[model samples]
Target: MSNPNSLVEGWARRYGRLEARPSNVNPLDEFSGLSRRLRGLRLKEWIGFTLLHPDWYSSLIIQDAHYLASSEIYAYDRAAAALHQHAVTMRSGSMPMPSALFGHRYTAHRGDYSIEYEFDDTDGRHVLAIDIAETATAPAISGELHLDAAHAGRPLSVSSRLPGRRSRMYTHKAIFPAGGVLRVGDREIVYRPERDLAILDEHRSLLPYRTTWLWGTFAMRAEGGVVGANFVDRPEITGEAEESCVWTPTACEPLDDVVFEPAEPADPDAPWRMHSADGRLEVEFTPEGRKEVKRQLGLFAIDYFQMFGTYRGVVRGAEGSYEVQGVHGVCESMRARL
Candidate 1:
């Protein structure tokens, strides 16, 4: 197992300039294998949908759910293990447009669970609806989350070609003040309009057989305004182009590489320290809860751990410095063979 952080230094110098992509650009339009000559090898695409609240975090994922691949639909409560459920479905063939992982209108149904994801406007506002019936492993959960992103403004998007492969990775992240209503069995949870926040993570990539990455993100209310951060260390990217940023209400500031160090690897609730090389961002994350998933099936396997906690430290932005204490969010480390 090699360290992924070692692959990010001098990334821009070796790979050239990493540009800021437009928020309105459709990722499917930039497929590297669009030409007729390279269509045979274009086989991977996926989307990860997430909703965050102060008390809990919910995720609905449709990975390769539209094409000739083994698509998976899973929903989980980040704070509780009793609310996790998943199902796998196999598609017969492949199609180009209106893809469940990329297009504006996407929906999929498997067993008694169904999910729909849509991009509503150019400003990164979207909707995600998930309905799950009671299963043997979890209770019934249903919600229609409306992410009105007027406050978080524009998104931070980046695209890059994977080295030594005919593939590209495009990622878009936007954080906004969110409000919705959820029903879990007989209990109802209401997310007030001005009291909650959510993050939209849209990832479309053509990846290799073996992939590994470390990712961390969070959004919370500050004294004056809102704050958000996205950090990643992966083999497909490096240098100034790495998807790292500190987001404010007015602007998004690109950050240098970040390093994640855990106080103890065996402890899921261990404190983790995160810092940037340029001294612009620093924080200590103390985990309050965690969600762990492990799946192994011969040639394909995934091991993922996500910790929810509060950030206590300071972050310097363009306007001024802001102190963060007891701000809620999540941090994760993942290794996958896809």
Candidate 2:
């Protein structure tokens, strides 16, 4: 599906800009010896995951970022207004790159967090197991989520080379049915396939020195079926690969650039409005709470905010229009110099 000598870029237009499930393409083979260069030190990779239930919000994020291994866990109970957050950072090697190609197995250990993702060919699903050992400072969080990829449709997988630099990036986004029992402290949050969903955002990119982007995603029931979306706005995306799309029960509908308008520029908990440039999508997000991170370590700096919220919107596609009513999801704004 790609030329050997050329950097893999863009999805096939005929395929709705969606690649086949379980892609075999590996970016490492193309990145090769570039990881040792000064420019390559800016490369960033991470896996951001979200599990959605009706009344609960949970996220486990692992980053082999720039030159540090970092992980975070955030869980919130909307009814009780309870929030649990823990983050740890350590100097370590980069995350396993082959996991993006085939997803055989990979693990990241940071402080008390141990996160693992393994693919089981027998059942054609990816199992995500997260174990956070209880310490004097925090409680334990353990869960094993089974992401049913065998039945999920194709994913939005795209690759592109930067315009004026040697930087390149590969990103994969998929929404699939998932069920699990996540225990946080003494409370148990259960997810059933019939009513819950999961969204996986995986990225392995050789980024520039400074990068910024606005990203939003959600999965929920709408119009008698399930519909999910991934909207992103990045200036470096030279149109060779537009990684924005709406995932329906049948196909992934490709979308043009999306605009994010915040009611209050600096407030992460404010209501945000989003619309597609072509007028095919419009949504309003009202955030309940946010996990905000701002830190500066010498030459490295990061200001990131990811807000958990509910979305109300309309998405017009070839099949029909999907209306989402107060569905749970997340939106993020990030600016980093790594």
Candidate 3:
């Protein structure tokens, strides 16, 4: 492992840069059929205290999922899992988070469900749309939104008061749409990732950093099948560096040696549906949509701090077929000059 912290930082800087991509530059993604490698890259082990509420399984909220984990990529996993725990553990608090306050929110509604997609108004500070997916009850709601990250860390700012919202906030919070189905085995629990998040930074040319870390949920089914599904990243593969991670949980262990190759969006006017390939595990993912979280780098655009989407891919195996679903991610912004 090269473990080049400086190199990784340099690429991070490039990812934020805005420039026209060189004609000869090719992305080494799953669709590209290029194998990515990782030696020593950026910070690896993410240490954080995490939490999850048991009611998450019964909730119809997208944030209320069966698994809660704290990952190192950017500590988003920890933030998410901790919020869940807070929602369940301390339903009412002086200062509270939404997920914690509504650990069992899914139990409140019931109905048949559907998926909706729409883009809200855009601002230089805030750029993104929301993907709303609903399901039958014990109902639950899953809405994916790319809120403003441009000013996420900015100093105190007045937020637009969302209309028709009555929940009081000791502290302000951002939430996507709510309502979806709660599965029978949905358990609200937080954990350290079962598998160490993999980094392809050192080995993969597709990645920009001297190294990058991939974090995701890796699990197995009751039928003795393995399941490894999590988003991966190849920051700085192209100027607007791309990031992606895919898995099959039905296996004994998370699939390894995955790749990302992309094709222009269906309409050639839509987002690209990149293929996440892992031949050794016979798993691949076709992205369904993209959610832009952040777009920066002066007007030319150098950095992209964003998220995208993925769909369950049909895994071809010697014995039979397997279904992988609920995939999402982002590499929003071209010539990411970060």
Candidate 4:
């Protein structure tokens, strides 16, 4: 078999810009046609969320992995400079795919810990309800969050084929108005709809044995309107299907190649600088706190970093320019071999 990375690079060199499918298309139907080039090759899926508020940045990650299933909940309090995290993993675990892309429920459970990400539509607007339960650990953390799609723009959806094989990857990202209350031990943090927002990430990819990627996303309120973006720097795997874009209240604008520069690459909480080749995106990130994970199970290993930060810069697009001022967000870098 050919190396998936090499095939993706060559494909990108030959065909510059990859086209994305319409958001209404079903990803599972697209996956059904692929011929598994190698047995035991993994098809991974996950539902990730980030809710940003003035005083707290909270996130929930649920992975429907084949090698190892896991769920993680994390929050950073800016005022007290405190971090709370809870996670659980099970080897050789798996989850069923959602019945449909738009209105479906996805879940992950292990022992006394469980997570659910349910999606539905209410009067033409998208609604997502997230619930987490962790009854096994001390100071156990749990919560329910409600998010509604408030932007008028279409979501950024990419369903691209890999080179030299039938493998593929599908990604969907969007920003929404969020509100909720999280119970952390004896304390509670509330997210107000007026000031808080959430970013939703849904991914399904049939990947090779080794892969790595750098990704950053943030959403903020600007004078123009609500602004959000998703940036990824991993051409070897994704090629021109970068899924990088600047989202506005009116539309989603595809972005050219982007670059991520960290003041201290080794530091999980280091400040970051990001820019696009087209000179449309220029931003600086100052992190308030971060969560790091290092895990190894048999032949699988991963090193992940998720940082909570505030963004200060400008995002120029076809509609207009958005001035980002102290907007709470998140950025992540990860490498894994499974």
Candidate 5:
């Protein structure tokens, strides 16, 4: 077994920071150091795409989104695969989200069904759009979603190095009002800026061959205000401060490490409890639906499970305390051998 304290210290020496920075910094440029400065070292690059709403959550993920992982790139529609279309509804007793392994494609640059990022001194934004004709498992789906810092406020970003590997993790989370329309055949779910909230979970990393982590994020209306949070626990995250924080309309409050208690048997429908050591955050997650994918290919495999659900809790910040009730979000557990 590894000494947890020693692992954390090692990470802090390489990646820990004392403060937060704005999200406008280009992640591609930040992570380019090792690859650019050194030769014959391995690097993995990709952008995850996600769109969240009160009624549902949709994702069109393009791993190796930029074809930076290697000289050759792949795009396929398959469970536990890198590129695919997925969606989950939030209704009570709702069925699992529809996932189809088709209409998967990849581009090296920003274009239709591609992930795009732009940032400058004045603003920053990341956009993802996809259009899939009707498939065997679901209806036609199309939509465009972007996270705009000019409108949503600055995001929280973290950049760190992986232990014992010539790799790094650069990630950012932006929570803001999202406006778009996801048309599922004839049923259109419009995301109005006045009512809907969205979060952007952008990550690019070159991880070890085997990795495991626990992550959860929530965004919703609480006590007449908007609240959003991102929390994670992984062995590679050795920094003194984990990538955890709570975002309000006006400010982002950095938080200490969080503790998660998954129900025994790890049932998807069971209530998962989470809280912070300082007593600043506490919540009970009741899952409505889940997306589970398991893939095994000789030496490489990925077992990923994400639970979409509603949260009820209390969050204390510099401004005050906010009560969160029936707010929709996601919690995930992943074990992977890359």
Candidate 6:
């Protein structure tokens, strides 16, 4: 019933202090633009971001892409590292986010990413959504999955799917390194390289099923510090990268012109592959190196589907002519009622 971490609540109270202030920023103006921008592009370029906590019993849903830019930690890292994530372009044009989606995009630089949803009721694209990403680290479990001395966070948590579930809360804190704090909370974790600050958790809600969810962001630093970036939370399990994106330094914005294509899986236990438009990148995430952080609450069997390392392959922005490597991190899993 209550988010154990109380992150959303904390965010509401401290959002102003931690992130930049525009005073009159509107969610609809920021998020809904995704559709109009891509109105001319092929339908294949539309994408959405979402977070799903699935288990056998109760599940929590968080859907956001460009609702608000309240956290500077994200806004800064995302805008700073635009090359790695949204390799194509964050938006198609400038239409604004759909009023239905409950999310926002935050970055120190507004030109790096974009947001948009398909306007199915009247045509060109039948989707509506947004995506947020930065050069930050996601929650992790040390090098190994077991309770190691360096392990942090809630020690890996899991839950299941229960439609219409109430919002669960948790303190958005991480055992961050020196100066790695994003939006000040009880703790901080490094999501960026070196400091590796964890891309701490935030508040989440739900979108209609059959609707996609692509959540989380990632990027890499290259020559002159030009970062290619993208964020996705495709929770539908259908395996689509339309909402998943990656972009370069110039022309980056939210819900504008973002798109991703999942690469074919080579191994049964490896991270899946994905590519941004124009084949600038060939990125894949491997979960084989992760240790399972499991927890069971009610009919839900939740596990932090984590791999100690990550699998990455890029050519230009983040990838370099068919290059490949393993990345270390954890993947989350939750199962709830059918």
Instruction: Give the whole-model CA lDDT for all candidates, comma-separated.
Output: 0.62, 0.75, 0.24, 0.68, 0.56, 0.28
* lDDT of each residue in 93-186, candidate 3, tens digit only: 2111122111111121112222222213232222111122222312222322222222121111011111122100011112121222222213
Residue 175 displacement (Å), model 6: 16
Top lDDT model: 2
TM-score of each: 0.79, 0.89, 0.28, 0.83, 0.72, 0.33
What is the RMSD, in Å, between candidate 5 and the native fold over all Cα? 10.2
Model 4's lDDT to the true fold? Answer: 0.68
Cα error, residue 311 of model 3, in Å, equals 2.2
Q: Is 3 or 5 the stronger prediction by TM-score?
A: 5
Say which prediction, candidate 2 or candidate 3, comes out ahead on TM-score: 2
Q: Locate the minimum summed-lDDT window of 10 residues in model 1.
A: 1-10
Cα lDDT tens digits for candidate 6, 1-338: 22232212322311211111122222122123665243212111112221111110011112222321211111112212211112221332332323222233222224433233222222111221223343354221111001111322221112212123221111121121112122211222232333232222332222222233333344333343223334444342222112223333332222212333334434436445555446665566654332232444354233433222253766454333334454332333333221
Candidate 3: residue 272 lDDT (0-100): 37
**CA shift at 201, candidate 2, in angstroms?**
0.6
Pitting candidate 3 against candidate 5, the one with the higher lDDT is 5
Cα lDDT of model 6 overall?
0.28
lDDT string, candidate 1, 129-164, tens digits:
777787776667778777775566456666566643
Rank order (by TM-score, best first): 2, 4, 1, 5, 6, 3
Worst 10 residues of 2 by lDDT: 7-16
State the RMSD for candidate 4: 5.9
Give the TM-score comparing model 3 with the true structure, all chains together: 0.28
Better of 4 and 5 by TM-score: 4
Candidate 3's error at 133, in angstroms? 22
Model 2: pairs clashing at backbone N, Cα or C within 3 Å: none
* Candidate 3 deviant stretches above 4 angstroms: 1-226, 231-257, 265-278, 281-289, 294-302, 305-310, 315-321, 325-338
Candidate 6 structure, TM-score to reference: 0.33
- Greater lDDT among 3 and 6 belongs to 6
